[model samples]
Target: MAAVSLSVSTVKPLGDRIFIKVSEAEAKTAGGILLPDNAQEKPQVGEVTAVGPGKRSDDGTRQELDVKVGDKVLYSKYAGTEVKLAGEEYILLSEKDILAVVA
Candidate 1:
């Protein structure tokens, strides 16, 4: 079967964690073909496809997540642990590693 990169289903995160699907940029193509690996753009952006529940603090209060699933986000160049889902690459990281949300 052919692979589908994006999914509409929901994936709830566990705690203080999030699941993001890195967005692949369009390859620089001249003859309608993709560019070589060296010519591709560096990955720096992704969409939050899943989010964990709020984490509990020492005070017993739940700290809510700043980001939610479907939110476009920016992360550090070397941040996040890379993961694979449904044959696609994903990133698992804490909210701290995320630099900003793309609005």
Candidate 2:
């Protein structure tokens, strides 16, 4: 799907999902040589730009998400749907897919 240019107000993740702004892969290694496009690893960490209204519990009450907007998170690689909006990349994934929140 074509990504919509992101703004916290423009996109709201549904259910237990979240919107994450993926960090760019490093263009160069520690040695300073630029890595080719094929050599860069997929980034698993990102800043949460937006979040859903929270998931429903078995009792039908809303359960809060562990991560909030502006929280840095580590997610499973190849877990979420990828979208590019106005040349910027973002991911939409369920909260369960998030591995951890970075301190």
Candidate 3:
């Protein structure tokens, strides 16, 4: 798929998908030790910035998604394809890839 080029104010997810503003990957340890770039873990948590109209069901009706914009969620470590928009980082993934919503 072509990469989306959108400003956060205008972007909306297209299908049972969501746009996430990825949290910055941690750069230091709890002990205050600085970590190199390559040592930082790929962040799996992010805040939902936009959500799609839910996926179509077998009967062709759309089911509502469990999450909404602003929900903090944890997804599979490698779930979404990363994209940069208006100088900010984001990931696009299906709702199924989100493992949990951080309450």
Candidate 4:
């Protein structure tokens, strides 16, 4: 089998799915205490990298998504599939999984 190569530019989401670049987990506490790698929680925030066209409507039309590329957003903690490309962590999830735009 031939090996496949994946890159951010080569990926496209179908339906209402979205691709996001995960933010780095905090390495230290607010009190200036250093935390271990395993002690940090998975970040629920990220920047939208790619987005699907839209979800299909009952009349075969496409419903536009509220979020757009480069928007910083917060999502459900357990939602989305984790992926790594070029050593960068990312998540592919449905638009519903996104809780809010971070402003």
Candidate 5:
């Protein structure tokens, strides 16, 4: 198989799928104690990078997603597929997995 190249600009989610760039995990706690990498929890917050047009309704109408690109969002824990692109962490998840859009 031929090698394929992938980038943020080259990715386009389809049918309510969303692409997000994961935020860095907190390195220190509120008490000012440093935590090890293994002790850090997976971050559920991220910035929207790419989004699908919309989901298809039963009547064949497209239902637009509430979130858009550049929106900081909180998603369900254990949701989405983790992706590594260009040494950066990302997540590909369905719209349903997103809990809320951070203000």
Candidate 6:
């Protein structure tokens, strides 16, 4: 038998959470000089690729998620857990960590 691999192009996070792919860091600044890899700040914006089933509140009701898949979101500079899927890097975070959904 041949080895089989499963390609998960999509994932569903659970409970007030979401999955996003971090944007690439800027390679240069307006000063016209290239910045070192470490000099660039970690990107805070990313495109939402997956969403979770809303969380349950104490009231016995589920809180609805605000962001949807394909929405560009801005998150905190120091939030989310880094993970790898299908050989691609991704982040799993709670919706609360998301600062804003890009208009």
Please list the Cα RMSD from the true structure of every candidate, rounded to 1 decimal place: 5.5, 3.0, 2.8, 0.5, 0.6, 2.9
Clashing pairs in 5: none
Best by TM-score: 4
Residue 99 lDDT in model 6? Answer: 90
Local distance difference test, per candidate? Answer: 0.82, 0.90, 0.91, 0.98, 0.98, 0.85
Q: Write the per-residue lDDT of candidate 1 for residues 54-77, one digit (tens) a residue.
A: 788999988999998789999988
Per-residue lDDT for 41-66 in model 5, tens only?
Answer: 99999999999999999999999999
lDDT of 2 at 8: 49
Per-candidate total of colliding backbone pairs: 0, 0, 0, 0, 0, 0
User: Ranking under TM-score, best-scoring first?
Assistant: 4, 5, 3, 2, 6, 1
Q: What is the alpha-carbon RMSD of candidate 3 to the true structure?
A: 2.8
Between candidates 4 and 6, name the one with more favorable lDDT. 4
The parts of candidate 1 lying over 4 Å away from their true place are 1-11, 29-34, 38-41
TM-score of each: 0.75, 0.87, 0.89, 0.98, 0.98, 0.84
Candidate 1 clash figure, as a count: 0
